[model samples]
Target: MSKALDHDPDHWPRRLVAVTPVLPMLPILIVCALVLVGLVDGSGVTWVPLLATAPALAATTGGPRGVLCVGLLSAVLGVSLGIRGDAADGVLAVALASLLVVTLACAATSALRGRRERVLAAVRSVAEAAQQALLQPIPATVGPFQVAVRYSAAAAEARIGGDLYALVSTPHGVRLIVGDVRGKGLPAVGTAALVLGVFREAAHDEPDLLDVVARIERSLARNLGTDDFVTAVVAGYPRDGQLEVVNCGHAPPLLVRDSVVVPVEPVRPAPPLGLRTLSGETPDLQVLPFADGDQLLLYTDGVTEARNHDREFYPLAEGLARHTGDEPVDTVTALHGELLAHVGGRLHDDAALLLLRMPARTEAPAPREPSGTVRVESCSP
Candidate 1:
């Protein structure tokens, strides 16, 4: 059966409290009320026939054990009501038979539901493990830059998605890549994993930033389908005072200098990662002056393409400009909160944002002379 996975780990407490303790006993309460009505009315209509409702209702909220308990209690209440109302023996027998059938059926249903829940839990556990292995977390700082990243998957249960980002400090310098796969679901996830694997490996091996990008493109071309391609930006700080960026059909990264936000558009446009062969164009490496107090923000299309109810796309560049701060973590947090607010709390597609900031360099003070040792000073009169 195709149904929504309504299990949310965040709201499980509220859901449990709503359905437990009080709700499970509702069936017994109903049976008691019906018994009181039958005894008070003394009608020939025989309300004992309604006893089957107790077990049927129990199936909706409680488990198999609770359903059986409700069914047994209802049968006893029905017999008492029957005797008090002077009902026929055949009527009481039929009520008992119906209650028995309903209770057994409800018990079976509860068991089936429990099994499905277990299966869903197992699947969710495996998904979490896969997410940990595939998309490892990045620390707050890498190399000489303060970094922060935020990612959201459209599938709530599947926390990982096609959008990927990684930052590593290598012998050459700090290397990073932020990219988005062309689609969603398992296929897109596979493509994303492939790209990240190559990037991480090549980021360490290849000294040149463009060579790292080329290695990723070569791997994707061999493994990915003809139509499948990834848009990415590969960046590196191979030496002091320089930032090398290679944009492969991805959105231009926002460069923040002295709290001013500017998009670092590629000098030469290039096709996406896997489509270089078809486009017949090679990616260009652009090196910029990355002085202290300069910041760069790399992101996927998901951030820029996200739309609100009025169908207006998110203004990422403007948001960064407004929320720019000295700390990368604070800047990314503000931007993420605004993005969610813009989309009305949930994004329709995977979104990733990575911000790296170069802290202002400070000069150390000169060493002071010891106070205990008195030095003879010659003064010219």
Candidate 2:
């Protein structure tokens, strides 16, 4: 039964391939129809045979090469047919002109294909290099945190885009950033890279989370386009079980405790980084009490904005509630898969998720007595 279904003629690709043989014959069929309609007499024989070459030529050669090959073959066949039919001057002139036109067109199209291929190759290389340098890998573990991150670009074939995530261990603590630039493609990627680059450097030098964010903002404003901006959440763990977060027009991070999800409310959110001129006030840092076994989820708008066929936006919190538990990596992988399924296997915008879990602390064992001197005799032994 499966083999029969697989071999069905209704299969899409099979049907397309089945039609391939007829494609080369279509022009010849058209010529025959025209001849039957008395479009021309025996003089049209040369043109009819030449037309038959069109489909085969198109199929075998692409751009200029195919056009040229078809034109040359058509001209040869036309001349042969013309000689056999004792064609008139008018017929011979028309055949030669048609061949010349076809040859020129084929040459132009082939040149165009070559140029387009080169441009596409260059763009692909740049995008790949940009992804490597801007989207640094987020280790499965960082500091006292177990981490997992998933990133997807809206543009197919591109693995990275305007959305960015970075997690690094610095002298201060574990610092991370999850951000989305305001646009897409090369421009957006440039801004994202700039912001992340600055954040990584500042996260080490600055003691305060807000200072790190400010540094990123300054760098973006200096380097990015006038209208460009980045919405982001910058966070740091200060080795004191407290998570410091600064929200800059980005979604609030979620805190998962005991398998229940709660959004970390921003005390005050400043406008996105590049808009510092419009809103001068800096974002106020909020300290969240993060105990062992707690997990924090940071994500871009792509997660919340994904919609199903019914056009209903995905309920990330609800999805998280249903799938995520104590394991950070498992929770993230499950949510990422669910999110993809919810969106019908394709995301319309770039999506990114970062999960960090603080493992439950183990109590320290009692200190051992000095081995050499601590022989309290064999009291009980």
Clashing pairs in 1: none
> All candidates' TM-scores?
0.84, 0.71
**Superposed Cα deviation of residue 291, candidate 2 (Å):** 4.0
True-vs-predicted CA distance for residue 12, candidate 1, Å? 9.6
Which pairs clash in the backbone of model 2? 64-106, 64-110
What is the per-residue lDDT of model 2 for residues 1-381, given as tens digits with 9 covering 90 to 100?
001112121254567788887765554454445444333455544454456446344634355555665666566666656665677868777767866776676567667777888898888787677676778666666788777766667764555678888888999999999999998887887778788888889989998787888788778777877788899988899966898888889998888888898988787768988889777878888888999878889999988998889999988888777876655556766776677667666678888888888877783222322111000000000
Per-residue accuracy of model 1 over 336-364 as CA lDDT, tens digit each = 66776676656777887888888877722
Candidate 2, superposed: residue stretches over 4 Å from native: 1-93, 96-100, 157-160, 220-228, 276-280, 325-334, 340-346, 359-381
- Model 1's lDDT to the true fold? 0.79
Best by TM-score: 1
- Kindly report which residue stretches of model 1 are placed more than 4 angstroms away from their true locations once superposed: 1-22, 25-57, 362-381
Could you tell me the TM-score of candidate 1? 0.84
